[model samples]
Target: AQSVTQPDIHITVSEGASLELRCNYSYGATPYLFWYVQSPGQGLQLLLKYFSGDTLVQGIKGFEAEFKRSQSSFNLRKPSVHWSDAAEYFCAVGVGRSQGNLIFGKGTKLSVKP
Candidate 1:
């Protein structure tokens, strides 16, 4: 079965500080990996995705992720987080023939200290 695990359940970072969220997955083939951010009372927005080719992929809102096949990980990174960045971050994997639905890891809630 395909699944994703996020080690950290919550994280607190001061504004303008670096941030990193860890994610690991288990899949039979090269799965479609994605990072999404959800704010209060809002739907998730795609941060980044890895389909194939280059491992490091850039994303919106100053976010980036690297797909490590050996480790089965796709970790999200941001050089400097903003106060508005305080939200929930999720790492997901799309497996098999599933088109829109994704298998999401327990989200990591980020708290930005002012």
Candidate 2:
């Protein structure tokens, strides 16, 4: 079985501060990892992914994630945060690779301060 874990249910940061969302995954072998963001009342949008080759992958909206095989972790980081950046972030893993099914974490809700 494959699963994703987002330890933090919610996080708050100043509008100009830095941000980091933690994620952990479990799978039998190399898994397709991803990060997505969803604004309130909106659908999920792809943030970034790690399939092969480079462990560090860049994504849209000034986001980047590093896949650490040794730790089974894929943490998302942002050098600076903005008010519009507030949203629900999810870390997911592609299961049933051929079927294209996904197992997603509970998600982390981000709040930005003025």
Candidate 3:
């Protein structure tokens, strides 16, 4: 079975400061890692994913993540955040099952300061 753990349940970052969210996973084989962001009363938008190739992957809104195989960690980072970026961010692992639904972490709520 595959599973994910997000150390931080929530986070708050200033409007222009950098941000980082930690994620760790456990799976039998290499799993597809993804990061998604959800705003108030909105659906989740894919931030990024790691299927193969380079360990580091980039996503929308100036976000990026580095996949560390040894540590089984995929952490999301952004150089600078905006007030509009305030929302709940979820880290998920996609399993290669018939259903494509993702197993998501608890989610980290980002509060950008003005």
Candidate 4:
């Protein structure tokens, strides 16, 4: 079965510290991948996506991810994390060609310290 796994359920990072959130996927073929952020009481917001293109994809809010086919990983990284970045981050994969067919990871909650 295809799935997305976010190893960390919760992470705490000091303000201005570098951050990296891991995401791994299992699928038969190269699948469409995405990273989404959801704030408290807010809906999910797209941070970035990877389909068929360069290995490195840039995203909104100074975020970026690299698609590693060999490793089956698409990890999200940021040079510095802000308190505003504290939220829940989800890693997802399109199960089918259709955009609606997606399987999302449990999600990782990020907490920023002062």
Candidate 5:
């Protein structure tokens, strides 16, 4: 079965420091890549996504992700980290054509240090 993996269960970064959250997917064909952030008691907010055209996709909140077919990775990156960025980040792959056919990773918890 196709799945997504976030190697780091949790990560800590100092304020104003750079951040990179890794995401890898295992699928026979090219899959839709997505990154979402969920704050405490809040719904998931889309950070970025990669469909077809661009290898590097920009998202809201200064987040970006690069899709590397060779590595089967769609890692999310931010030049600087903010205290409010503390949340659970999820990397997902669309298993099917439908948007609902998403398989999410266990998620990586981000902690912003002061």
Candidate 6:
């Protein structure tokens, strides 16, 4: 079984400040990690994904995540955040060779202050 945990329920950051969101996963085999963001009333958008190769993977919207196998963590980072970046971010783990159903964590809502 694969599961993801996002410890932070919410985060508030000033616009232009750096941000980082933590994510942890538990899986029997090597897992596929993804970060998705959703606006107030919109569908989720894939931010980034880590399947293999380089531990660090870049994502859309100036986001990036590093897969730390030692810690079982795939944390998202942004050097500078914009007001538009405010949204609910979810960490998901997908199992199997094929793109399997994802087990998502409780989302971390980001609030941007001007």
Assess candidate 3 and give its TM-score to the true structure.
0.94
TM-score winner between 3 and 4, please give it: 4
Clashing pairs in 5: none
Cα lDDT tens digits for candidate 2, 5-113? 9999999999889999999999988889999999999999999999999999999999999999999999999999999999999999998669798999999999999
List model 6 lDDT by residue over 5-102, tens digit each: 99999999999999999999999898899999999999999999998999999999899999999999999999999999999999999977786789
Q: Write the per-residue lDDT of candidate 5 for residues 1-114, one digit (tens) a residue.
A: 899999999999999999999999999987998999999999999898888998999999999999999999999999999999999999999987864688999999999999
lDDT of 3 by residue, 1-109 (tens): 7889999987888888999999999887778999999999999999999999999999998999999999999999999999999999999998885568688988989
How much is the lDDT of residue 66 in candidate 3? Answer: 98
Candidate no. 6 TM-score: 0.97
Q: Write the per-residue lDDT of candidate 1 for residues 1-114, one digit (tens) a residue.
A: 889999999999999999999999999887899999999999999989999999999999989999999999999999999999999999999876557669999999999999
Residues 1-114 of candidate 4: C-alpha lDDT, one tens digit per residue: 999999999999999999999999999987999999999999999999999989999999999999999999999999999989999999999987865798999999999999
Give the Cα RMSD of candidate 5.
0.9
- State how far residue 56 of model 1 sits from its true place (Å): 0.5
Which stretches of model 1 miss by more than 4 angstroms? 97-100
Candidate 1, poorest ten consecutive residues by summed lDDT: 93-102
lDDT for model 4, please.
0.96
**How much lDDT does each candidate structure score?**
0.95, 0.95, 0.91, 0.96, 0.95, 0.96
Residue 75 Cα positional deviation in candidate 2, in Å, after optimal superposition? 0.4
TM-score to native of every candidate shown? 0.95, 0.97, 0.94, 0.97, 0.97, 0.97
- Evaluate model 4: give its TM-score: 0.97
lDDT: the better of candidates 1 and 4: 4
| RMSD (Å) of each candidate, 1 decimal | 1.1, 0.7, 1.2, 0.9, 0.9, 0.9
Clashing residue pairs in candidate 3 are: none
